[model samples]
Structures are given as C-alpha cells and as structure tokens.
Target chain A: MDAESTAASKGALVDLDEATCWSLLGPAGIGRLSWTSGGKPFVVPVNYRVSDGRLEVVTAAYSAIARECDDAFVALEADSTDAEHHAGWSVLVQGTAAIDFQHPSSDGPRPWPAGVRRQLLVITPASVTGRRLT
Target chain B: MDAESTAASKGALVDLDEATCWSLLGPAGIGRLSWTSGGKPFVVPVNYRVSDGRLEVVTAAYSAIARECDDAFVALEADSTDAEHHAGWSVLVQGTAAIDFQHPSSDGPRPWPAGVRRQLLVITPASVTGRRLT
Candidate 1:
C-alpha cells in the first residue's frame, strides 16, 4: 500500500484480538519479561523466540537473575509506535516460569546459543492478554 | 472538530517528545515497578504519583519487597492502547530506590493512604525514555 493510503486507513485506537497478539509474539524476537525472585521485582530484556505460545530465553547459571527466578510469576510485553503509524499496541502475558534444567546434550531441545551457559527459563503463561492503540 | 478532521489530523506514528512522556507519567496513577532482591526478581503493581521527576509509591516496613530492594535498580513502566486510536506508547524509567524510613508524624509528606504502612519507596530515575506508536 502507498504511504498516503496507509495513513488514511490507519485507525486511532486498536483493541487487539487474541489472534493478533499471538501472531505478534510468535514472530517477534524481543521483549521484556518481569518476574519476582527472592521477594524482589526484576525485569530483563531478552532475545527470545516464542514457542508453544510462551516466552523462552536463556540465562547463565549461578547468576543473580537465575538464582532468584526459580518458580516465578512472569510477565511479557511488546509494543510499537512510529511517525507513519501514529498507533501502537502492547500485550502482557502473566505466567509461571520453570528451568529446563536437564543437560542439553541428550534428549530435550538444545536450550542455549553461543555465550549462554545457565539453564533455560521458559515462561508458560497462565494468562495472556494485550491492548492496542488506534 | 469533526470525526473526519480529527482522524485526518492524527498521525500514523508518533515519536513522542520528552514533554509528552513527562505529561503522561505525571497524571497517570498506575504502573508496574520491578526490582531484585537476595538474588531473585520481583514485581508489584502500584498506585504511584510522580514527584520531582521520579516515581513514588508506598510500602509497609519489613515487607519482602522492602527488605530486598535496598540500593537496587528499579524500573517503572506505563503504556496505553485502544481501538479508535490504533497507536500506543511505552515509557521506561530506570533508577535507584530508597525508603523514606521516617515516621509521618511532623516533618515530611504524609506518605500513605488508608491501609498503607511501612515507609515510602521513591524511584529516582537515572534514565527516563519512552516510545510511541502512531
């Protein structure tokens, strides 16, 4: 579509549907995940790939973030806004997290990329919801 | 203005200026605050008010969030999205936090509402930035 036509077609507010949210999270490679560990609040930006409708990321072992985040309540979020698209949207997924603690060499998926030493943290969302701007 | 004119006037994307972000955070009263403690992550939904370019909220003394967050890095976030306006925005303020640690008898601001105890946790944002969707 041309720029003018796209601008004309854009809406001012958008209440995103569940399908749209799923699509956005599935294809996006980045988002912030918030959780509670050791009774304190924490947020980390991760390069993540969504799988099974959940957020997945890798972390180093024995680190502060890993140490605190065993069995936690996690929230994931994504949004966008720009000049040509005076609109944006955000989705939040709140869920429980667990470590794929099994060693990577045997049965389960290869959990880490280069420079990733700790176990994998998978956020299995209990409630996934989102909102959009028109 | 009529609906059509307003619609036409709306931009597709908006690169929000600092003034706009300040305005949005200032008037709004709700956001999520994240922090780390004892090697774990934690997050709490708060009813906050911005004061002196920082985010302020109340908490009880001896709380888990209070004990772990001493001299910690905290993040505060706010965003909005809708259908009539297909746009949204997100602002992140990262900073150090501290408790007022004082009783609310004679000197400082009365820190809590009804059902609020403990001291105050004020997030003095070291870096404040935001993005908008057009």
Candidate 2:
C-alpha cells in the first residue's frame, strides 16, 4: 500500500508539516515535560514559553524537573482539544534540556506556583512533530 | 530545615494526597502518555477514560502508541490549568501499559480521529502523585 493508504488504514490522522508544528508551539502556554529518572519515565505539567525558537520553563531549583531535567533528553508536548467537537491538534518537541542561568529573554515564562523559581530549563528541540485530528 | 520548611523553600506548591490525585484523575478526558522508545522519551496527547481505577486509551493498531507501549512502563499525566487565575492541579500516573483486547468496559473512550482504533491500552498505576498550585 502507498503512504496515503497506510495512513488511512490506521486512522487518517493527518501528519502535520514541520512549519505547522512550530506554529502550534509558538504561543507560550502549558505543556507537559517528559523525562527519565531512575530509568523510569515521568511527565509533569509546566508553564512554558517559546523563546528564540527554544522552549523555556521556569521551575524551582529543588523541584524534580530542575533536578532531573538538566543535561537530559526530554520531550515537551502541547495540544488543544475540543471534546465536544472531537477535533484538536497536538505538537511534540523532543530535545535536550539544560539549565540556562543567563537566558537573554526579559519576558520569560513566569511559573504560577509561588516560590523562588530561579532555575530555567531550556529545551532545544531536536525534532518537532505533530498530528491533527479532524 | 524541617519538612514543612523544606516545602516552603521550594515554592509552597502543595503536595496532593493519593486520594486527591485519584479524584483528579477520576473524570475521563484528555491526557498525555509518556514512554521511552530507543532510549528516548516521547509524549503524545491521548483521549482516555478511567475504568475500574485504571486508565484506558483507544488507539489505532498500527499507531506508535500501540506498538511501543505494550508491557512497557509509562506515565500518564492529566491536569487542569487556569492561565488567568494561575491556579491548577496536575496528576501523574506512572505504571505499566498492556494492550487489553478484553476490556469489559461498555462505555470506553472513543477516539476522535477517523480510524479503526481497536486496540485498547490499559495502564495500571504503580504510583499516583499530584501537586496543587494555589
């Protein structure tokens, strides 16, 4: 079967182009950061911003994300869904995260949780993929 | 410092008890599924329902989720965030996933995308953790 047929056979979920994926991720919003700790996977919701085409999250220094994500490969996922309409799009950004003390952006993401969220987790995407459910 | 002080030092994000975590996950809705494939982490948004205290997702048989998740340890994350209020709660369910062909649920989650989503992925939680940002 051809690629089109293959996609249709599975569910006809459209594979979004790279540009569309970036467009979906351009707005600063809530996203889930997935990483491995102790050889186990963990996912947590975080407030994020797209700065210079990279994902940035402000977190507490003592939080699990700050402790485990630095210098590690992680995946950040953001999506919007309408349960009533049964339509939405999802974008996935997989990349390496590093602690950036000197993020040049003056307007970075401000985490909602109250505390000294001094540490910045910067994720430079290695791959950006997405799908649209229509 | 003491435990309470330690929590305060981090940012005062309240640690939710297991019962509360279950409560947050009780309603069926959109959640992200995270898993490791080829030593790299991947996260995708999925429609899920909690049946008998277990998380269930319906996906295409040929989808990456169906192929990579069976018998593998994974993490399912669900949350509600109010960007304006800056208040939200997130629940994380970490456990093993198995493809269940015999899911007895008569009212399982129906995939929104157009396709034959016959495979049912059931996640039995090993740990349920959550935090509330007030």
Candidate 3:
C-alpha cells in the first residue's frame, strides 16, 4: 500500500476490556515465551493455553529451555491485530516457573487440550498486567 | 472485523527478499527486545534502529535489564504487517551483549540515530537468522 493509503486506513479504534483481552488469547494457539539464559534473555515461540489466570505450556524435558531454568523470573505475552490495525490487545504475565514432571503423558482420542506431554512449564503469576493498543 | 472478514482478508502474500526484510525495520521506530531476567524470560517493547548489521538499543544504566546483563546472551527482533496481512517479515539476531560505557552521551542534533543515552545493548549475534511471511 502507498504511504497515503496506509495512513488513511489506520481504521477505527476499539475499546479494550477484560472480556476482549481474554478472547484474544483464548484461541491463539501460539505465543512468545521468553526466558533468561546465563544472564541474557531468549525468546521462543511456542503453543500455549491460558488456564486459571496463568499460562500453561508444554516442552520437551530435554529442551534447552528446561535445562536453563535455574529458578529465576520469567514471562509470557500474546498479541494480535485486526485487519484494519484498529484494535489489538496484549497480555503480559510475570511469575515464577517450574517443571511439572508429573503432567500427564498420553495421546489418547480425547487428548488433554495440548496433547499428553510429560513436561509442563507452569507459570504462577506474581503480577498479571495487560494493555490494549487503541 | 468479523471472523469471516478476517479470514477473507488474509491478503496477497508478498515475496521474501533480503532487501524487503531490511526495509521493513529500517523505518519502523518500534520493535521488541527480549532477554532473560533471573531464570525466566522478559520481552520489552522499545524504539530501535538497524545499524551495522546489529541492533543498537539504549536504556538507563540503572534499568533492570542493565543490572541483569551479567555476561550473557541477548536477542532483538522486529516485525511489521501491511494492510492486507499478505506480507511481513521478522529478523532475529542472537549474540553476546556488552555495555558500551563510552557510548556517546548527548542529545545534540542528529544525535547518533537512536540518541545518545546512558546504556547500550550491543547484540553481537553468534547467529543472525531471519524469516519472511509471504
């Protein structure tokens, strides 16, 4: 699109509410997960689910991420924009992370949501913050 | 926009090229900078510039990021979508980070692109990877 066209199509802004924010992430199968490795930060894209006000994600136990979680703070964020770029909201959750090794491991007909995975990254929020771009 | 409209307007995909990836970020003032804090991960939005094949971002010396950069790796990424959602590209740089203590400290005219501030997050990527969504 041309600069003029792009500027003219900025679109209408949508007001953000708790319901809207929840809706944006409820079905978004993908989100970015960030963590620190040896002091610097690393961000990895992963499939996630929101359950009980926190994000529950599964990863391979032998993944580099699991090997590096040395009892430090971590966060997860998800965002999406509409066709007009008029409305979008971002939810950020900050909290402690742990490996839920006891998580179920099964791939039956009715798999548990994100499949039966042996490893789980459980994020317990110390703070839940969100923002909407209007 | 309704779900049907959103799906119908996925737009025409754009061909990927190195020049296109560079151009998308060269002018976009905002990008996401991710790093590890403690043992978890954090993603922060900041205004950045593409300079010398690496991402140069500035922050306060006392910023939590600065304190946490205790000899570790870091990464920076930028992405943008067009009106049609048909084309976009993302550039990710992974590298070692160091503080440029002697970085120019000034707000003078043409102040070195991203302004002269207290701290600099110099991401010298061991691997610079990029992807384009067409």
Give the winner by TM-score: 2 or 3: 2
Counting only residues 3 or more apart in sequence or on different chains, how many pairs clash (N, Cα, C under 3 Å) in candidate 3? 11
Off by over 4 Å in 1: A1-32, A35-122, A125-134, B1-15, B38-40, B83-85, B103-116
Quick one: best TM-score, which candidate?
2
User: lDDT of candidate 1?
Assistant: 0.60
The CAPRI category of model 1 is: incorrect
- lDDT score for candidate 3 against the true structure: 0.57
TM-score for model 3? 0.55
TM-score of each: 0.48, 0.88, 0.55
lDDT by residue for model 2 (B1-134), tens: 54445445334479899999988877688889999998789998888888888899987788999999999999999999887777888999999999998864334787777655678999999999999987
- Candidates in descending DockQ order: 2, 3, 1
lDDT per residue as tens, model 2, A7-63: 464334688998999888876888899999876899988889888889999887888
Model 1 native-contact share? 0.18
In model 3, state the lDDT of residue B15: 41
TM-score of 2: 0.88
lDDT of 3 by residue, A1-134 (tens): 55455335443323455565567678435556677655556665555767776667776556655775425477777666442433455566677778766766331111012212356677777765555545
lDDT of 1 by residue, A33-105 (tens): 6765434345544446677676766765765446755686677666554425444556766777777887352
Off by over 4 Å in 2: A1-12, A104-107, B1-12, B104-107
